[model samples]
Target chain A: MSTASPVLDELLDALRCLPGVGARSAQRMAYHLLERDRQGGGRLATALQAAMQRIGNCVECRSFSESERCALCAGSTRERSQLCVVETPADLAAIEHATGYRGLYFVLLGRLSPLDGLGPEELGLPLLQRRLAQGEVRELILATNPTVEGEATAHYLAELAQTAGVRVSRLAHGVPLGGELEYIDRGTLAHAFGSRLPLN
Target chain B: MSTASPVLDELLDALRCLPGVGARSAQRMAYHLLERDRQGGGRLATALQAAMQRIGNCVECRSFSESERCALCAGSTRERSQLCVVETPADLAAIEHATGYRGLYFVLLGRLSPLDGLGPEELGLPLLQRRLAQGEVRELILATNPTVEGEATAHYLAELAQTAGVRVSRLAHGVPLGGELEYIDRGTLAHAFGSRLPLN
Candidate 1:
């Protein structure tokens, strides 16, 4: 028990605001900052400021980007005809990392949650419609998560895209790789049943 | 696996860099990033950057600060005669939270890990010596951790401070709260026995 400083307290409090980080973690992080060399802290600080200063939502796909368009959107060679709808830029990134996806992306930014008052507007669906109307996008892939809200959003977007004369498809659902069928839920089971496989 | 992205891979790699967060946790965190809102990730990025940008080490106490002098160093009203030497700024914070002490602090940032090549110069012992040379500090309290490295560092600091004509004191060796004295190691027991209190 001794003299305490308020500046350090403020820094610790700011660190506390990080996700999944508790008071103890925040304190540890603060100590790490204090204990680490100026070079490390200085580099971290510079990275933070640089990201804040440069990164923003892409104008085209709403993905995080250093400019108005993200790297994917900025690239001219990638297919612009087929559009994959996802919940966030991270989802788009996830698909990109997995490879073989050659279509453009329409980042919805969020899913439909009527209870939470989040609707098509909150997800920027109007922009999606406008993009579809521009005649470049022919197919719309509903790549939302398999959760209830995600399913609902996918269904809604599929119907909307159908009316726009854009062929719609959903991500395939079944037992995940390295995952047992027993752990699969009833909804997935029902979908698997509807899309039954041929006997060997 | 229908939808995969390289961004997810990068994000996964980034997640692994965080302390105590490993591959499985990194996967969980990445899944969370895909599922959760910008509120969490955005805030983390901002906080990480802000802390790096604004926070720095205190010139006097060697704790993290956002200004030229930390709050403790800046405060003129606190006790300046006694000094509490700690392994890290978080230790100072923990002691401060427990309340009562009003002496100044001197953070070591790290303990003496000879195998890891950490030494007095790495811990800013010269600065501490200069401070003690001024003769304002009469009592030097060693509040280092109870680990072997911590004990060694405390002893080394104690010797140095004592050599500079200051009264050196080490923190008491005691059974931790909720820990059984019987379960404690033999070395700790011996130390606790040597520093035992009188029978009431």
Candidate 2:
């Protein structure tokens, strides 16, 4: 967007890169920044810089944190011996927010896809095996999503952990929270049916 | 977002604050930044700073610009005597992209809203008057939208310009280009009826 003004144009162009934002939104945000909150905008700008500077992946779980370990990793209550492995931090958050499990996490950062050339190495699975070999973990819970890649990744990881003399379990299959039965896809329903458990 | 790491948590929190982004999208963007584009993240942080440092309003038209005057303000070709007033820079861009008018612009930055205590003073009518009094203006175009506040603002500005001994014109009202009769709103259809033009 080449506006008559160069600097103003640059600012607008930069804002356009944000997810779902357009030229109009960028202009409105820029207008709000200039007219409404110079002090807040300055703080926000500073905060953005400081955050990017400080944030990095933790050595153990690959979760972002200011220090070498993340808060969850450092916490005493979280069970380190029972690792719940997932594909991303958002998945960790979703599981935590749901809150039935009381274990620590191992973020795979990605799923294995041979077609995409993202195998166990790409998913940091070799490191996971080494971490499991430390003889700390008892049960390895495969908590990945129910997609084809997720199922494939889970099976592959289960095989790896079994070879290392550890028990492997997956999060139970069922109707998801807030799921509409009518809207539920056929594959998920079939899985739920096949993996049905007795009522407690 | 209390990750063992404070930096990563803060970054995730900030990213989540962006409009319409859910936890999933936020984590994806965060991972993308961490794994692939740390330098780009750093550059975005700096870009935020640079935009704040450089962006200021155009004196003549009151839109954002790098210089004291915007590119449109400095342009020799834009008609100084023909000023088209609008509510914001977004409005200006919408009109520009629609691509008919060929004149200068004056951004009011807001609209008249009695409910919000946004009267003539709040809408920068005084600044507009100052522009009219500068004597280069031959015709002042009320190119504001035909919505309630837009109409009220246009009428108010037209009255002010008339009192200042300048001519006033309004954007024509009718069905929009590429609009279907069934889809046209009742108000627009009525306005078109009232202001029916002679057949060429």
Candidate 3:
């Protein structure tokens, strides 16, 4: 997109660093900012700079924070006996929003993948072990995703919890609430069938 | 996404100013930058600020430029007798890349949409008139899009060119090359049928 403008070219290239943006979308975004929304573009730039410079991981849960501890970890009212562990801050947000659970959270930031060089230390398991050793938590809920890596991370965390004398639980894997059994996948149907709960 | 972080909230809100980003994409982008690509995010911030503050319209052609006149308009080798008028700089770039046209360009930055408060003055018709009055251009090529507003703008520009005693031409509109007749839309097929060209 050599519009005979070097600044425009630089902007287009910079916009492609986003996750799903490609060449065409980058061009569109650049043109949009230059033509119609310079103010918004400036605001976005300020926000991006501030976030990148100031936001850091919480000392306790390792979630993004501007201070030493995140707001969630700093709050006094939330139950500390039940710790829900998730892979990312987004997952923590989902659990916080959807469920009534008032327990604290531990964000892994990523799953354990040796191939990608993500090990126990990368997931902050040592910090988690120290937190479990404090005896403040009685239950460690494995709220990781249902993927293979998520399950493996959960297994590892379960052993850590057992060593710390804490109970462990996992999120249920079954057909969705409103989904028909006919439309459910075979694996989910099998898992639900195998783990069917008795009616009272 | 009340991640219990005000900075994160601000970042998400600012990200939504982009064209296609929404709630979910904003969250995903924020988390991605904080977790995976802080350096890229910082670079993007710098690029955005620099482009927004420094990039301005070329006085000669109304295209984006860092200086008073764009490189294309300032070049001495291009044909001065043929001036192409386009709705946007992106259109100018598309013509530059896809064809052998070596004429200078006048970018409107927008078409004449009266409902949106766009008129002759807004499209820089006064500046264009002064250019045409110089009498150096022998032909004016109307390369605006084929939309309704585009056609109206082209008609207005054609009259302007005629008043200056310059020959006027437009980009041909019809079925695209290699387009099968069976799959082509009705309007394009009908237009192609009506404007059948005579073979040399």
The most accurate candidate by lDDT is 3
lDDT of 3 by residue, A1-200 (tens): 56687778888888888999998888888888888899999999999999999999999999999999998889998998999999999999888889999999999999989999999999999999999999999999999999999999999999999999999999999989999999999999999999999999
List model 3 lDDT by residue over B102-164, tens digit each. Answer: 989999989999999999999999999999999998999999999999999999999999998
For each candidate, the alpha-carbon lDDT, in order, equals 0.74, 0.78, 0.92
True contacts kept of 3: 0.80
Best by DockQ: 3
Off by over 4 Å in 1: A1-7, A43-47, A133-135, A181-196, B1-60, B64-81, B114-117, B121-138, B160-167, B180-199
Give the winner by lDDT: 1 or 2.
2
| Native interface contacts retained, candidate 2 | 0.46
Candidate 2 chain A, poorest ten consecutive residues by summed lDDT: A38-47
Scoring model 1 with DockQ, what do you get? 0.23
Residue A137 CA error for candidate 2 (Å)?
A: 0.3
What DockQ do you compute for every candidate structure? 0.23, 0.49, 0.79
lDDT of 1 by residue, B48-113 (tens): 556656776778888777777787778887799989998887788888788688888998888999
Highest TM-score: give the candidate number: 3
Q: Which stretches of candidate 3 lie over 4 Å from their true place?
A: A180-183
